[model samples]
Target: MKDINYSEVNGYLFPNLKGREEVKVNSYFAQMKLKYLKTNEQGHLFSLMAKNELSTYLEQVEKEANEMYERLVEEFKVKWNVTEKLKERDQMEWVQQMNNIDNVVKEIILKELICN
Candidate 1:
């Protein structure tokens, strides 16, 4: 185990750990996954923490999920005929269709990437 230095602040001692802010993830998918892990996947979460890999793993998850999201959006757009032509043909209909696609894609991401 590595040494943990401490500093006195406000009549309390806190471990002086560097780069702790990296654990504060920004991606919505990543944050959801972290919460899920904390509540339902403690063993895996502990394993990552033991190796000091939680931040790195979450970052990777965010990147992969984002990439998958973009790819899936393109595929769904093609499958649903949500093209520029549709947008030009019927603006209201296109907007509705895109809103539906966005909701469905978010659900897919939550199930496949964030939760699982």
Candidate 2:
């Protein structure tokens, strides 16, 4: 019996299968055949299908990774802006405290000079 290539069979059955869906189906059948079929012809066909599937999967992963990196960059920018605002608030508080201390010291000096 001639070994059957299920990926080719599927392509014939789903002539309209295109894009990721087609790749996914091909990959799934290729994996199933690799697991269950022992014939040389089926093995070769399945191997080819698997290679195409892997290429498609890698492309999808790369696209997702780029999107995730962009999201992380935006998040980092928001966090940095918040951190800068907090630092500014802290500096303002420190200056206010210094001015209060200076006023208290001036009052003390004036009191002493007037008394003496």
Candidate 3:
């Protein structure tokens, strides 16, 4: 049997454990989707498992999110005129613009890939 770790909370020990179906979901998108599934859609997640497509589904979502992020960054850079020249002229402006783009992309990913 696998070992279970415990956490002591106020002199009480509680088993720090997860379920047997431990799918390895990496990347921000995959993690978000996994959390959503575990919290709100266990039946769907288990259905995917029974169909032998959970990994593939997560992988595809991760890939699509990553690709969308990259593409959005490139597009936003061009659209917002965030270029090497701007970066060289003002480092703060470059950073702010990049951060904005990142936030927008993450919002898009959350709505399109994760929440839904």
Candidate 4:
């Protein structure tokens, strides 16, 4: 028997098989389809699925981020007795603080939701 190169097989197959249980189960047919399917068609299908999944995830993140930002702003307002009639420097400081907090929250969200 010939020595099978696991790395080669993984490099060739993983992209096609990743997140696809049916293809993993029917690997022989999957290999056949890879031969028959045009490369552009396969790429297009992968791109479409990726875009759909990413958009759905982004929508959820946007909703969550918006809610969190609103809550944070409300809390800050109540905690600091902030009003719409604040002085210019105070308003700028508040905006800067909110932006800093937002950056931290966004990092956490991306790490938790997208990197995991």
RMSD of each: 5.2, 26.3, 10.1, 15.0
Ranking by lDDT: 3, 1, 4, 2
lDDT of 1: 0.88
TM-score of each predicted structure versus truth: 0.75, 0.30, 0.76, 0.36
lDDT of 3 by residue, 12-114 (tens): 9999754445467877899999899989999998888765678888999899999989999999999999999999999999999999999998999899879
Error of 2 at 53 (Å): 0.7
Candidate 4 wrongly placed segments (more than 4 Å): 1-51, 88-116
Best by lDDT: 3
lDDT of each: 0.88, 0.44, 0.89, 0.49
Better of 1 and 4 by lDDT: 1
Residue 12's lDDT within candidate 3 is 98
Model 2 misplaced regions, further than 4 Å: 1-51, 82-116
Worst 10 residues of 1 by lDDT: 16-25
* Order of the predicted models by TM-score, top scorer first: 3, 1, 4, 2
What's model 1's lDDT at 70? 91
Instruction: Identify the superior model by lDDT, candidate 2 or candidate 4.
Output: 4
Choose the strongest candidate by TM-score. Answer: 3
